[model samples]
Target: MTTQNLLVELFVEELPPKALKKLGEAFAGALADQLRAQGLASEDSLVTAYASPRRLAAHVSHVWLKAADKAVQQKLMPVSVGLNTEGQATPALLKKLAALGADVSDPAAAVAALKRAPDGKAEALFYDSLVTGATLDTGLQKALDEAIRLLPIPKLMSYQLESDCELPGWSSVHFVRPAHGLVALHGSTVVPLKALGLTAGRSTQGHRFEAAVSPVVIEHADHYAETLARDGAVIAGFEARRAEIVSQLAEAAARLGGGVRAIEDEALLDEVTALVERPNVLVCEFEPQFLEVPQECLILTMKANQKYFPLLDAQGRLTHRFLVVSNIRPEDASAVVGGNERVVRPRLADAKFFFDQDRKKTLASRVEGLSRVVYHNKLGSQGERVERVRAIARAIAQPLGGEALAQAADTAAQLAKSDLLTDMVGEFPELQGIMGGYYARHDGLSEDIAFAIEDHYRPRFAGDALPRSAAGVVVALADKLETLVGMFGIGNLPSGDKDPFALRRHALGVIRMLIEKDLPLELDGLLAGAWPVFGERVVDAHTALADFIYDRLAGALREQGYSAQEVDAVLALRPQRLGQVARLLAAVRAFAALPESPALAAANKRIANILRKAGEVDPHVNPQLLQEPAEQNLYQAMQRFVPEANAQFEAGDYTASLQTLAALRGAVDAFFDDVMVNAEQLDLRLNRQGLLKSLHEAMNRVADLSRLAA
Candidate 1:
């Protein structure tokens, strides 16, 4: 048991944050695969990888000093495609394998040697059988080199433009950015590998601004991280980057009075990481005049245009002051502060002018303008959509109680896109929905109406929130439903993975809102009623696109802590009420853990098997054809249970209905046990099948129990 480790580092100019993160992960995976492929990674040692904007590194411990034994399996697809039962290569297999350069001759051909992987006998067969063998079993160093070569970098380019070559200068290797150098060490052992256009060395570069390209030598594999940090670069991984941002923002904001609060800017943080090797806090203030603009305008101008953070007062009011994270310490910081402030003034001024001008027109006045702003060619004008929304929202809202949420919803839906007519919102398209909400409130519309306008687009993404207010929920559902109906009407149904219109998101949005509010509206009928509104534009639901909405629900239920099977069970009952489906899923999980389901499943299976065998026949049984007492008793039990089960199902008590069916399981088991279902007499068999068919019919009214996998 000897000990050894290999460390490799790549130093490059800053790469884009997303590309860096992706490449980091991909490189790490590729490195592990390379190690295992070469037997350098085993149960005995570990292989790990890490990446940041400036560097990517991988470490393998107990790495074999010598290359491991290798046996390459090349394809012989054509030759093996129609191979015989005996160990012989088809002429095609021989031809293909020969073209593939496989040594198929002498003792045995490649296809001839291909055998059904013997059970537990050979590891190679299992590895080789994978789709495309999608695994590497080559030399460790070679595999690492190959993986780097194959890594996908967005916007890849050659650095050098000349030498009569259109081919760009690769990092002298394939990478999104230049690979300045490589550091390769083996537990302080230098594993020379420069031939791959990479150096085997113990040294690495420091911060691009302060430390420049100065290389610091590392003595050991574990010290690689610590040494980089000590060199004033927070390369301890992404956590270092995140921690720096939080602390710097807090410290920078504290000097002004309140701590800096993070804006809704996941994308900005990523870009910042790529732009800096070291992070330090910097705060600057602007003229108070900018604060008069909409907070979104103020915030967006800084984050999107200047990459700055707009400050907030203790009361959560936007202040003119802002923060910026910098890569270098400023001697006279005012230079940096003044530079950013100067750039933001023009952008903020444009926002203010738009806001002032937009307030001149009332939301009602802009209603006619929405007709020109087409929602979807199939969905009709936004004005027409507002009408449908008004109708749908009114029907859905009045029932939510004390909230007057419905009126608020109708008001909001009418004003939802009215901001599009505004000059400011036109320039800042991202502010479309938010500006509408702001304008409604500014124009003295109720808070509920304003909030509904804003929150209608809530939970826009998978994990996003659903509207909590009744009015918001109604409008959100109405807005989504109209879009769905209009899309379906015009033959724009999404097929396979293509959903250019985001109909899937709209469907999920409606379902999530209805479920959240416990609205008891029937979705199928709601969709059908909107037919007149959609007219010839109604798209058919023949594709899986309709069920795809349910798939979204199933996913949402899982996020709420229900297992996929439990969700499936609830949906199997065809429960249209999402809230009930949620409760039903909980019940199914509880019942599944009980001692009764297997017995019930078995009994349910018997009923299904009988019905399946009977195949599309009438459920009616001749009373005279039942020769056995058990058959009569089972039939009697099911007949008695049907009324209760039907009521439970109608009330969405799926579990209770399932329980009602379960109660008949004992009678069902007895009937099948005590009687020969395939009776010798033809009429008797029909009678028995009819009895089972009736049992199935009772169970299915509650759920499509036949679809339930045992």
Candidate 2:
């Protein structure tokens, strides 16, 4: 068998910039996977993916010209059914052999060739044959077809291909884009195949305008990338082009020499990389007076609208100059720079206009406008949602920080959604909470209130920061709680991977604040407080919503490196104060490490089963009813250790509490080994059950020890 490196490329119209990276990876991965599955490529084959604005390609090394032949054995039928008692093949056996393309000309010879093997209780006849392997041409065709079928194309386009015949007609073809050419080479030979109405060739177009050659010619499979770069004026690999863009951006920023750097956003970088073939970083600038608007507005406009990188100074203030990644490298470059600067001026001016007009009316004035803005069809207007949040925030703050904090929280919550009516926020919804803070400050509100209004939407996504002030924390909690409860109450719970309202994120935010802030409020109490705010708009879904929050918490804890068993044990108790969950998990981990942990856990499981079966056994045990020596010893051990464990638990030293309880493992094991929990006498059985129940309660103060049982 001969092996050679292979290269394949698809030349098409511009691809969607956001999906280019994943498209390239999926294309190459599926191609190589299909080849390996067909045995035309080995496991150690190196696969390199190339993607540009107009092309997707892959180079795979160590691909076989023809896979090696394999010996295969297949079951035919049971021996009793395939052969007669005369040791001759039956008509059914001959027919099966004929269908398998076996030598059926001589029935006796065919019968002799069959092997008998035991399959379960019966012996079966097996056929042995040599299966010919796939050739590169056929294998590559299948791989190409599969790769294209498996592409994660965001959307498909339908176009017509001109007919090759004399008849004037066209054929419709559907693909991500109107593909014009395909290059497939095994070593130096072009693999004969056709896809998307184009025959495989050794040449492809590159860098729509700047290519040194009209059509870049790939001389060999190994030379695809090098030849493309030298003749086509394009960087074929996605990561290579992205890295070049990064390096050029850094160099251009260094030339400014004020400790200035481009704002770091990976998504923007990737999208920009996908939009260009040969990246040439150019310095562009806008009027410095545009700086009057918030830097966030300028940054968002540049990155989101113009795809430009806004430079920031040492103090993290936006500079007048920005960097642009141009596809063409012109010598003078002044025209490119001027054109980009001119294009961004109107966008900046619009943001400034919206900012100026928005400040004329204070956030308090805009509060009335939110009544007209619909939040949810079932939940009424934003005005109604604002009142609910205010109520919840006040309830949360009253217990956490007394009356002053409650007043601050109420004020912040009242103005929080008011910005949704502002022109600036209306134009850029991402800046809803952000614009509120600016307008609040402009209205002569205190910094505390302004910051709270802004930070109320904190932790909008995973890894995002929480609120900075106590008032902000209250408002954020209230806002997320209102969403969770209201949505869950309306039976809009997240199903499968669908969470249109981001209910899962809201639940996680609530959990993070409760635990990370270590707020003294109970989880159930917070949910209860939020329910009444909705009044009759929502049904009683409190239990379901709490379960949802706890589930999110358990997942989060597991992601933070806690084992499933540890999370299960701690969460099993439904600890209302989520702040203590981390400590409970830590205690469980510590308890699980004890040498006596297994026996105690097993005994705890046994005791749980007994108590459950006993049905409502009291924890109180009359000392006189303790007849067994083991039972009396266990009671004495509990008297010494249970109080100490209870004291440690009360002090929030969960690890110490669990460790203290570990001291009774010996007595617990002895009691389970010697005494019967369900005795013949009713009094004795109830007393034994009561003793076990008391032990169960003490052991489970930190976490359910039974869950730790292996």
Candidate 3:
């Protein structure tokens, strides 16, 4: 099993910058995984993924030139079927032997050599053979094909390449981009293969304009990255290139001498890194007058449209100076700096024009235009959706805040979607809520209303921040609830990771807000309020929606480090106040750690099963019916501690409440050990069932202890 590090590179036109990181990782991972599965690479083989604007590559350490030979025993037909009663080979066995490349001239001899093994209920004949190892050339070809097939390509480009054959022809090829070359090396020797109409070679093209030498030759499998860097003028690794860009941005910003720093956006940084090979961070500036526009608007245009990093000052305001990642670094870099500055000026001017034009028509005036904008074909227009959201917002606001907050929320919800009609938002749909906030302020609205308008879409994704203002929280809740209830009601529920409307995200957002904000709002009541807003347009499926939200909440809690049993215990009750779920989970954890938790949890499970079997058992206990000592002792324990636990529960001390029950573990064990819950005497049986019912209720006030049962 002689081994050498392997390197494979696919050179193409510039990849989709945003998708490059994922594509590169998928390519390398799929290649390594397939190789390992085929026994061409060991489990500990290290894989280094390389991705740049023009290429995706991988360097796998300790890959075998040929997979180890394996001994295999393949099952044939049953012994009875393979051999006749005379112990001679039958026609079926002779045919099978021929197919297996065994000599069938002597059928009896062939049948005698076959081994017998039990397969299911019958003894079956088996063929024992050794499978030859796969050569590196063949295995690498299969791996290369598999890796290309598995790339997470954002989009595919279909193109034709000019054939180099004597017979003139054009070959059609489809890939993430038009792949010009491929490099596959095993210790400096090119692995003979073909992919995407190109033959494997040791040479690959580098940065289109900055390569020190054209068609840089990779000297060895281990030297692929270094050779490309020195001669091809490319940084081959995605993370390495990103880190370099970060360092350059910092250094370039420091030279400006204003306590300025590049805005921290890892996604933006990655995209910029993928857009350049040899990144030359240059400080470029625009006219300071453009600062009058919203910094968010300017910064977004710069990053999204131009792929530039906007610098921020100490005050957290946008600075005129920004950093550009130039692919080529020429002496006296003034031309590159000037070109980027000149290109950004027009983009900034467009954003400024949109901002100024958008402000001309106050958000209040844009309300009527929203009716023409469709939110959903079945849910009606944006105007109707706004009304539904406004209604839900006001209903939510009454409990979150007083009439003042209600008014603010109503205003914000009504105008939140109006920005869709604005030029600025139309140009950049990502700035929908953002531009609305600006317009609200321009209309001389209160700060609370403006902030609420912007923050209503808070927590757009996982781990995103929630709304800042009370009014914003109310509106955000309303908006999310409206979507959930409406979508669920319409029977357009999410199915298997296909949430076209991002309903999962909305559900998680609601859960995060309720749990993190510790809002006093009940989940049922909120759904009840949001449903009527849809009026006759939707069915009453709020129960299903509640279940959906709770499911999301349970998963989120588990992700936050709670065990499945802990989550199940707390969520079993369907506690109306979602804010209390965290406390319930904490209480469950503390109770689980108790020394007596296992016994108590098991007892609780038994009690639940018994109760479920005994239909409609009253919890009212008659002390005189407790003839057994174990029952009497458990009754006395309950009488003493049930009140204490209840009191703690009422006082919101859930941990204390669950902890007080730990003292009753011994009595519970004794009762279950000695007492007959289903005695022959009806009175005794009913009374005993009643006693267990009382115990069940008290133990499960915070969470269903039975669910924690093993």
The most accurate candidate by lDDT is: 2
Give the least accurate 10-residue stretch of model 1, judged by summed lDDT.
Answer: 123-132
lDDT of 2: 0.93
* lDDT per residue (tens digit) for residues 239-277 in model 2: 999999999999999999989999999999999999999
lDDT of each: 0.70, 0.93, 0.91
lDDT of 3 by residue, 34-53 (tens): 89988899999999999998
TM-score per prediction, in order, is 0.80, 0.98, 0.96
Residue 611 alpha-carbon offset, candidate 1, angstroms: 3.0
Query: What is the C-alpha local distance difference test score of candidate 3?
Result: 0.91
Rank by lDDT, highest first: 2, 3, 1
- Candidate with more favorable, higher lDDT: 2 or 3: 2
What TM-score should be assigned to candidate 1?
0.80
**Residue 320 Cα positional deviation in candidate 2, in Å, after optimal superposition:** 0.8
